[model samples]
Target: MYFSTSTLLLAALAPAAIIASPVDADLTPEGVPKITSISFSGNGCADPGSAKTSATVLDGTLSTSFSTFKGDSSSNCQIHLQASGAGAGWQVALKEATYHADVTLKPSTSLSFFTTSFWSQDASVTATLKSRIDCAGSDIKDSVTVKQSTATPVWSQCTGDAGYPGILNVNFRPAVTGNEGAYNVKSASIKFEWRKC
Candidate 1:
């Protein structure tokens, strides 16, 4: 129903009652990440200090799947680990296989990044934690051997507390000889804390 300006003006003189409810308007699915830490969801280049992913550039750059970025299963992305370069360091599973990086993240104190999807090499997958911030950078946070099953790729994770926080990158290596398994990596995450700097 439409009301005339004068009619509406008269209504203005009356006391108005207000109501509040959980409207769908305030509810959003893509709200800022308040989980263990922030995860990026935009930008072609997971730029320095930015947490997000863009489909086109990320797919091309990291050689990873777009499943996670599409919010498919909340996986965010999967490593689909490779065995060919297990010992040689991280090599592309396929030409398309790449890293989904969380860059230039500031830590309040000690921070941790967990791998929801782990790397597997038949029976085992050797994990290596590397600081991708700078090659010269030292301090490998945590690395260990992750157990795997033929059916599911196990998620063994590493943690990097804030030593300096320029940038840190994680890498998984081949543990057993000729394990020839696979690195089905997924749900790479980050967590931050304060150190009272």
Candidate 2:
């Protein structure tokens, strides 16, 4: 079995009145925000070298591939990301996320995928997405999307911890039960929205 995952971060800046000056060090040539650092943990990435980021900060794109990621019974991975270039008085929020996967399940077998995303400062403002498949046979493709509420968006810390990057933690779990099955996650992407404090 072969499993690979990649993450792409996209940002949309709010109105000019809400956004301050851009942080030169955190922006790419096109003025887009960049992911400065990313770390992975959990049983899915037990091998130190199995997971790696392929894109650089200058690319304004961050991608990770897992050479040995597969789900037979259960597998989980946690990803922590810190981004820069939102400006001095602005903060980031997770607007949406989409995950794609390919799975194969025998009769009476089922697979479930669950994801939880939240900012480090406040866990109350969190978003989650769950998907389940039952006896889907071989070569089944799946995709799930989770969107946050716009009326009451959860913003990152803006004042108390000034200069600290807005942090987002995402955890993904794939579980299988009943008979036997195979699951492989293809990719996942996150979209960010920025606003002033």
Candidate 3:
């Protein structure tokens, strides 16, 4: 009876063990990071067709810039934890991904890749932010484009093998005028974890 019960418990725990990896361990070639929640530290708002500037999209050094949207600067430019889609999310600590954390990534374990998206309520409107993580800590350079769909934000990302770790930062580069859709930069942020095989 005891042996049978032990076998059943081990079988039940097998899936979780396979799914969960040690934070500092190397990731499988196909393993991917599991994110239960996300957090945004800075908030900056800007209206369309305007030359607005914000520093929230920056890292600790406050380097990244925004020159598109024009909105109340005071209203935005703040940082805090917010929900991804639903208010009740996983953990802000993991979401508030600072460069400090990325820099401290396990040296030879796994790599981390990040991406973002843009969302809008108006179908006729569009916006985008491109992240330049080329200089970030990683085994190789990775780039991600955050685009705003019809009132919704969607994202796509890619990464290299081995392990990438370092400071991850993104920038929002606006396109020329007379574009099809008119949109503003609503938000800019980042989250990171190991990209398993």
Q: For this target, which candidate reaches the highest lDDT against the unseen true structure?
A: 2
Give residue 176's error in model 3 in angstroms.
Answer: 3.7
Among the numbered candidates, top TM-score falls to 2
Tell how far residue 67 is off in model 2, in angstroms: 1.5
What overall lDDT, based on C-alpha atoms, would model 1 receive against the true structure?
0.22
Q: Report model 2's TM-score to 2 decimal places.
A: 0.64
List, residue by residue over 9-76, the lDDT tens digit for candidate 2.
Answer: 21222211222443232432223456677888889877887767665442333345665667788887
Estimated TM-score per prediction?
A: 0.19, 0.64, 0.20
TM-score of 1: 0.19
Q: Per-residue alpha-carbon lDDT of model 1 for 75-117, expressed as tens digits?
A: 2222222111011111111111123322221222111122332
Quick one: how many clashes does candidate 3 have?
23
lDDT string, candidate 3, 1-197, tens digits: 01212111111111111223333323222332222222233233243323232333211222223333322111222222112211111111112212111111111222222222232222232222222122123332112223221112221122233122212223233221221211233333344223322
**Least well predicted 10-residue stretch by lDDT in candidate 3:** 6-15
Q: Which residue pairs does candidate 2 place in steric collision?
A: none
Model 1 ranges with Cα > 4 A deviation:
1-176
